[model samples]
Target chain A: MSYFVSPIAYIVLLVFTVLSGVFFFIYLEGFAQVQFDTRAQLFQQSFSLTEFVLQPYFGTISVLLLLIIPMLTMRLLSEEKKQHTSELLFTSPITVINIVLGKYLAALALFILMLLFSSIFVIVLYLKGNPDPGVILSGFMGLFLIGASFLAVGLFASSLSQNQIVSAVISFGLLLLFWIIGASSDAETSVVGYLSIINHLDNFIKGVVEVKDLVYYISFIFIGLFLTHIVLDSQRWR
Target chain B: MIKVQNLTKKYGNIVAIDNISFQVNKGEILGFLGPNGAGKTTTMRMITGYMPASEGRVEVSGFDIADDPIAAKNEIGYLPENPPLYDDMKVTDFLDFVAGIKGVQEGRAAKIEDSMNKCGISDVKGRLIGNLSKGYRQRIGIAQAILNDPSVLVLDEPTIGLDPKQIIEIRELIKQLGSERTIILSTHILPEVMMTCSKVVIINKGRIVLETTLGELNEKLDGDNEIHLKLEKYSSDIKAKLSALQSVQNVNDLGSGEFIIKSRQRNNIGDEIARVVIDNNWGLKEIRPKLNTLEDVFLNVISSELKQ
Candidate 1:
């Protein structure tokens, strides 16, 4: 909550909105070129606004979150330790659930805020033309879940160290590992494929919501928080 | 009230604090005195429930820390050596957040204002904590600790690194707070213990060497007394003559006709030392009792500990 009043919060918000706007326009331009091109005229009817613009726009922002969410969460727990404020929290009447959940929810709120700011592009699409509401809704739900999962991983990384830069690096590294883990999915690698964070979100982006993806993200968040709880509990005894 | 029983902390294969035990009554301030790295921080950490002890347990206001930490921790407020503060927060907002975590559900605004007023930080509640000076920052730390009105306050070197005026003001604040609450303050400073604590516990190398009321500790604290003498002219054998006297115990030559004479049991042997100097035909220019230092008090404790 204190971070909202500091310059770091505004700086991240500005960089994210500006960068997302540029990416939105770039994707719009690419979509425009496909509509007018001579050779692409035949396939134009096959790809609706959902396929070319909204899906990819959501995809680009999802990738953008890969960079921005870590920045937002880098200080979540790491700054608490670096400044020794964890002592104040630990010594107070607050439980570990209060600490972990408060920080995670705070980061999630900031993430939801960034998503709301970028939703202007979707609203613009809604005002200008007819797009599938189902696709848009599912796409947003995917963004929320994927964004939350990313934050969970980032929060775990933040708990692992007292250095913000190290926390960010570890967070980005872990996200990338999960992002590409699905690419190696094969007959023998089915278990690894099931663990791909982006694969679960792929269903939501395409206007399809599955129980497995919902279960996957909800369980991922729990596992991340559970690991954080273990680390914090042992940190005291250590 | 607070109680610690056979508390021990071990890190890996080395013992940090071994079988320590003490308690604080409802309104007494117990000064934890020790040298640097004497496990003062470790002990305070365990007492505050920030760290768990390897063996034994701590009970704060009748709740076992290991069994019911949240309830037990509710009774304690701690100020660590570094003052565990968030620099970017405004003073008032930080206090409000602290209140939320401490579960101060009723009359929070009044409590916040009262704590701020008590610590003398109400004037700077609008300023960023990071922009405050060391004194104001330290005061903010105290204000937050007292915000919830906890029963036990564990302060680890609350007056460390401050000017004399700030130190005196902090001591006064601590003494004032001690009237209604039980406080366990740790410091390596001798005068700090003397001024603010009702009882004193001297720890060294992870063990408590002595624990007594202020009256007895003051006797030991004021036990070391020596006399200094400066001569107008260089003198030989003056130190030997002074050391040989029945009243004087030892003498240190501070080169250029200056000597420091140690007396036994806080004796005022200025006349005996002057008689020795005059009879030895040594020029006597200046003479007075030596100034006491914190080191002298510590040496007194160590020597007394060795005696037993």
Candidate 2:
């Protein structure tokens, strides 16, 4: 709640709303041009809006979320430390779990709210095009899972340093690494490919919901929060 | 009540505080007296459950801090050397947040109001904490500490970085609050302890040099004020002359016409030293009694502890 009152939250929200809106219109126009080009071809079969438009649209939104979630979470723990407010929190009757979970959930809540606003774009799609509700919903779920995992990582990174910028950089480095490292080859059974965060998302964007993907995200979130709890508790011991 | 026994803290090989023991009963304020870097803050941190001790234990209201930290911390309201404040937060909002975390449920609004009133920050309750003056910020820091009405209150240098009037006001506020709570206030300022505390614990270089009632500390401070004397000429014979005086207790030559004269507080030694200088044709260049430095007070406490 304190976070929502700050200007940074609104600023990040505005930037996200603008950037995702622009991405939606740009993708819609590109899909329309492709449809027109296909109309000139031999076959007059229509193109799937979910395939040519919202899929790519959600994909770009993921990238946009990746860039902005760090800003939302960089100060969660680092600002508490820098301002010495962690001392206040630690001395209170609160546990390390409470501290870690409270911050993660608050940032996650704001991210969810931000995701809700972009649903207007989905509403517009429903009005104009006959898109698959299941695919769009699956894509939204993937974004939610990815955002949750990213937020957890960002929260953990925030605990690693007292400087907000340093935490931001660390989370960015970690997230980008997770996104690009095991993406070298398309081998489906590669051990390293399983570690790639983006690999799980492809199945979700294609309207496939694998239980392994859900487990991966939930476990990722758990590990991130566990590491954060250890770091915060050890700060007291040190 | 707060009980800290054999409490020790170390950062790697550096012992921040040695094994220390002390307690503050209900309604008594314990002054943690020490110079800067003397581990006063470290001990207070341990007592408040902000930092875990490397060895030993702390118990508050029968809850061992090591065994049950949440209960122990629930009883303690700590104001660290730098007050933990959210600079961008409104004063009321910050206090509300603290009240929430401290779990003040019954009559929460009234309690917040009373704390703000006690700290005299009610006027600025709606203002941003970053915009307040140093005194107001300190007051707000103190307000948050007292908001929960915890059984134990730990304040470190509460009057530091304030003007003289603000210091006196804060001292009065502390005295008022000490009527019920067990308070441990750490500071390098000696007179602050004398003004607001019932007991004093003097620490020097991470070790407790002395622990006693403030009344006893007052006596030690009185008898240990040494008069520094500087004459215009060398003083081989002057040391004996000053030492032989009826009121003077001891004299030590500090080389090159300088001497330290000691005497009990009841004696009138200053005029006698001057009279002796005039009669013996010795020029009196400087004569000043040192009384206020924390080092001076610690020297007396350490001497008494050595005797013990």
Candidate 3:
């Protein structure tokens, strides 16, 4: 709630929503042009709305979320440390894991709210064209998993510093590194390639709910949150 | 009750608080007195389980802070030197958040009200904490600390910045709270310790130099007692005659019938001074032993320790 109340959160949300909306309409117009050309030539085969519109839309959201998730999570622990409110939380009768999870969940809740806003585009697809419900559900699920993984990384970054800018930079650096790894692991099946979070989301984006991808995302979330807890715990000793 | 045994905190190669030990009995207000950077805040942080000690142990109500942090922390309430407040939050909302995190789910509303009333900040419950005055913020800090109704309260520099009236009000509130809960409040302010603390532990350079009750502190400070005397008539031989007394070590005459007679060690020099004045036909208007203040004792103890 505090995060939502901040103007920066609203600014980030508005920017991401507007950018995604513009990109989605541009893709829709291009797909409509191709469909018009096919109809003018009297072609029997129709355009797959899922291929041209839904997949591209999800892909764009994935990239946009990679940039925006850190903005939402950068202040989670860093701001508390800066304000000295970390003392109150540390002294309270709660474990470090509890603090980490509580903050992570709050950020995740905001991310979920942002995703709900993006769902308005999906509703347009449902009303205007024939979009596969199953594929749409899987793409949303994939977006959620990947976004949550980014938030976990951001959470860990937040625990490393009292400066929000430093945390945000670290988070961006880490997420960008993972995104690069995914892009670079085009032909390799090595362990490093497998560790790329973006690669794991590909299966879900293709509407295939593989156990390996699910496990990968779950482990990513787990590792991120676990590392955050360890950092917070080590702070007490320091 | 709280007990700290040989508590030591080190930052890399720098030792913040050396081997220090103290105890606060149930219902006793223990004043942690020190100069700036004297490790008062470090000690309080360790006791409250906000930070782990590099060495030694702290126990609150028989729960070891390291081994049983949750239970130990549950037994204590803490107010850090800065008050740990969220400036963006309203007073009521902030307290509610604290109550939720502290796990005071049962009767939380009543508890919040009670604490606010006790701290005398119920009127500003709806105002944003950042907009409140420093004194009001301090009270809110105190309200959060006492909201959980813990048996032990650890406050770090509870009255660092406030007006004289606010300081007195906070002192009175602390004294009232001290009737049931064991409290350890740290401050560099001398008179704050003198007025509010039942027992004071003066720390210098991360080590305890003196730990004694306020009553015994006064007695301990009587090592170099002085008697103040104001005479109506001046005599040339008054100073020499007063110094002639075995208990009188020295006489400092102020040239206007005002004199300060130094005693060797807690002697009854006031009676002797009175007798000397009567015998000399010099009218003695006022004569009394100059009591030693906590400030004198603090400076004397700290400087003596530094000298050693």
Top DockQ prediction, candidate number = 1
Residue-level lDDT tens digits of model 1 in B192-252: 8878999888888788887898877666545468888999777666667778888778889
Please give the distance, in angstroms, between residue B225's alpha carbon in candidate 1 and its true position after superposition.
8.1
Q: Alpha-carbon error at B300 in model 3, in Å?
A: 1.6
Q: Per-candidate RMSD vs. true structure?
A: 3.4, 4.1, 2.8
TM-score per candidate: 0.90, 0.88, 0.92
Instruction: Provide the interface RMSD of candidate 2 in angstroms, 1 decimal place.
Output: 1.0
- Model 2: per-residue lDDT, tens digit, A1-238? 3687578888988889988899899988988888879454558666889988888988898898889988888999999877778889989998888888889988989999889888789888988889999888899899999999999999999999999999999999899988986667754788778888888888889999999999989999999999999999888887
Per-model TM-score (chain A alone): 0.95, 0.96, 0.94
**What are the lDDT figures for the candidates, one per model?**
0.86, 0.86, 0.88
User: Each candidate's DockQ score against the native complex?
Assistant: 0.75, 0.70, 0.66
**What TM-score applies to chain A of candidate 1?**
0.95
Best by lDDT: 3
Query: What is the iRMS for every candidate structure?
Result: 0.9, 1.0, 1.3
Give the count of colliding residue pairs in each prediction: 0, 0, 0
Given candidate 1, what's the lDDT at residue A64? 94
Clashing pairs in 2: none
**Distance from true position, residue A45, model 3, in Å?**
4.6
Candidate 3 docking class: medium
Cα lDDT for residue B62, candidate 3: 96
